[model samples]
Target: MQAECPRQPPFNCSCTLDNVVWDTSRLYLIPIITVDCSGLGLTELPGVLPSNTTSLLVKENQISDLRPLVNNEHYRHVADIFLDDNLVESVAVLEGSPWLFNFRVFSLRGNRLSQLPTYALDNALERNRHVVDIFLGNNPWQCDCLFTPSFQVNTEEG
Candidate 1:
């Protein structure tokens, strides 16, 4: 069974429904939703997302702020977030957010990041104790005193 994607206003994107489950008594399709909003030249993220969305792809946009992902309740269940080739400069907002500790896949390739909040990320990784894939390639990373040691530690630990 397949269900049509819900019409979310203010954003145009493609949706794929996977992992379909059919319940005989309920007569409904339970789908794992993946929302693809890549290469839309968007300045911000979509205000609304479909229920049960687990993967969100918003790469190649102009999104710089991650407050929405941290502050908004709509993204509580999202596990995989691809933000490659965006304008994200800092991930400080993810300091204490659950997304830092619970995300399965978080990609930030080809962004403008030079440094990272090592303390928060280290704490989150320690707490997670789960296998997570984090992509940070293609960014202009500055290998300075503050970043080198922490990066080495995180890499060794992770």
Candidate 2:
């Protein structure tokens, strides 16, 4: 017999964790699964995620490190990720991960990121510049010599 995915009717939560109900109805369509667990006060990413998750919305939480998400085979299909209003200090989680390849929209607004590794953004740009939309605002950005070249180029281009 095939294992059945349990359904909770009262709250309409498809997946329950730590008494927090995850509304799985936000899933737009088959190829575009959107799991929105926003404003749940979550400290970390959920261990068991839907294997077909394409857009993950986990904003307004206390998630600090994203390293745990790197090895999760379930996250391989993620394209759009919204991690705003969290405690993310660094994106070392995506430093060398293959997820950077298909990563389309990454919004880190209102986080603790100081600087992003240009190589990672460069890789995403190399893949598809027009499809990538990275939002990095409302953080204490470090504008040092490391940013001189790119800053000058972008300033000139702008």
| lDDT leader | 1
The pairs that clash in candidate 1 are none
Give lDDT tens digits, candidate 2, residues 1-158. 01111122221213322222345798443433566667777787765555466667888888887865578776777678889999998885676677776677878899998877776666656676435577778867788998656634532422
lDDT of 1 by residue, 1-158 (tens): 11334334435688887677787899997778898888888888777777878889999999999987887876887889999999999999999887777788889999999999899887887787553788889999999987899888877742
Could you tell me which 10 consecutive residues in candidate 1 have the lowest summed lDDT?
Answer: 1-10
After superposition of all CA atoms, the RMSD between model 2 and the true structure is 7.9
Candidates in order, TM-scores: namely 0.86, 0.72
| RMSD of each candidate relative to the true structure | 3.5, 7.9
Superposed by TM-score, candidate 2 places the C-alpha of residue 43 at a distance from the truth, in angstroms, of 1.0
Worst 10 residues of 2 by lDDT: 1-10
Off by over 4 Å in 2: 1-31, 128-130, 151-158
